[model samples]
Target: MKAFQFVEWQRPGEVRDVPVPEPGPGEVLVKVGGAGACHSDLHLLELPAGSRSFAPPFTLGHENAGWVERLGPGATGFEPGDAVIVYGPWGCGLCMNCRQGMENYCQVPGLPSPGGLGGTDGGMAEFLLVPSTRYLIPLGDLDPREAAPLTDAGLTSYHAVKRSVHLLGPGSTAVVIGAGGLGQMAIQVLKALAGATTVVAVDVSADRLQVAEDVGADETLISGDHAVTAIRAITGGLGAELVLDLVGVTSTLTMAAQMARVLGHLTIVGVGTASLPVSFGSPPYECAVASPFWGTIPELIEVIALANSGKIRMLVEHFGLDDAADAYQMLHDGRIRGRAVITPHD
Candidate 1:
């Protein structure tokens, strides 16, 4: 089987022929349909060895969905050909958060992420070995290829937006910073659930903003000197009721703080390792700041529901496993307008 793997620290990942893996007890093997190329993997490659938890020598595709090839001993309920989306972030199943299906927030310490992001071989190959059947969600009517990004890009945005949904009511405003893959999904998630609230998207690239507009953003602004003022002006000087800073750098965080209304919510969703300074009267009065990890299993189900109902869809550019390197390069160069999914079997 040909798999794209991260073989070393600070080096670009490469495609390799690796042996197909078999499922163990309670495990399942999925014939890889599609795998998302996430930005976090780019961040990982830029970091020095040991700076992050996960190591290389593993296939690198966390956002995954495909058909069940076979089930190991003790695995049940799902048939051999059932199409399913994988829930990443494997965790100790007994933790309190895991019990509630929020495995991303599991209490166990130093737990490695599942294949692609950690020690396990991920879906970049023709097949992936899921630790358990519990991590698999039936894709229903959604195509596993287009639906693959719903596992991470879609789920992460859903998690980020779901937190501050209470603040987004009729006549409220919500600003999304960064119109990349996750950010694009965030915009759609807000539209599907945030009801009547105006959605504004901010990105440095005009092309990205155009994509944002095409998707559903009520307003699109370039992130520049006037962005803060523009957001306030659009909000009638009140500022947005909810601000989702998907970029999370110093500049975007500062702008997010400035665009947030009193008693609003500011949620940081990106992995841009920058800090936000906090002080009295900073970020307005009574504003809440939160950073959430990937969403729960239940929220993934909701995102799937939204897709199934035609309320949302992943704008995807397809890549074969052989062109996986080029896909990563395009993602790092910010050339992809929305999500990029690699179809290994194609």
Candidate 2:
């Protein structure tokens, strides 16, 4: 079978023929359906080898959905031909967080925390071997190709927004920075769950902002010198009660902090390496700032439920396995409007 692999550190991943994996006890094998091309993949390629705990030569995708092909011994609850979404995070099942279904915050040491994140070979292939059925969620009637991104793009946004949902009340405001794939998902999520909270979307790309509006954003603004003022004015100069920074660069972070209301929540969900030095007045007093990782298992189920209910859907551009590199290039150039999805099989 052919798979895209990060064969070396500080280099681009390539499609290569590899052995089709066989699932072991308690594991399951899934035929490749669709794999999301995330910006974090580009970041992983650019990052230095020594920066992470895992080395390369692993399959390169994390956001994935597919149909069950076979089950290893002792695997139950799902049968062959059932559609499923693979959870991105993989942690020691015995850990306290994993026991609570919060494997995103897996406390185990010395293993790849997320299934496709590091050392774990991911779903960018003809087949993926999931270590446990715990990482697989039934997709029901949803198309695996279209629903693949819910594993990461959708789940991550849900986690970030759900954490700060308490601040989103009727007539209150929430700001979403970077209206790309994850940001667009955040917009729909806020609309579905935030209830009557003004959902504002910001991005440098006017085209992407337009998509945000089509999805659910109540207001859209271009990220620039006046971005802060626009957000303030939209919230009646009180600033937004919740700010989600999907773009974690310095400038966006600065604008995010400025747009945050006092006693608000600012959550950074991007993978950018930029850092912000907090001070007395930067984020306002009583503001709670945090960088949340991917969603919990229960949250992932909820995200899938939202998708299944037609409340949220990912706008995806499909690519065959051979064109996966082109998909990555387009995503890196910011040419893809929404999520870039690679269909490893027909």
| Model 1 weakest 10-residue run by lDDT | 110-119
Q: For candidate 2, lDDT tens digit of each residue in 119-203?
A: 7898899999999999999997899999999999999999998888888878899999999999999999999998789998999
What tens digits encode model 1's per-residue C-alpha lDDT throughout 153-249?
Answer: 9999999998888888789999999999888888899999986899999999999999999989999999966999998898899999999999889
Q: After superposition, how far is residue 72 of candidate 2 from its true place, in Å?
A: 0.7
Q: Which stretches of candidate 2 lie over 4 Å from their true place?
A: none
Question: Local error of candidate 1 at 334, Å?
Answer: 0.9
All models: lDDT?
Answer: 0.90, 0.90
Q: Give every collision pair in model 2.
A: none
Superposed model 1: Cα runs more than 4 Å off: none
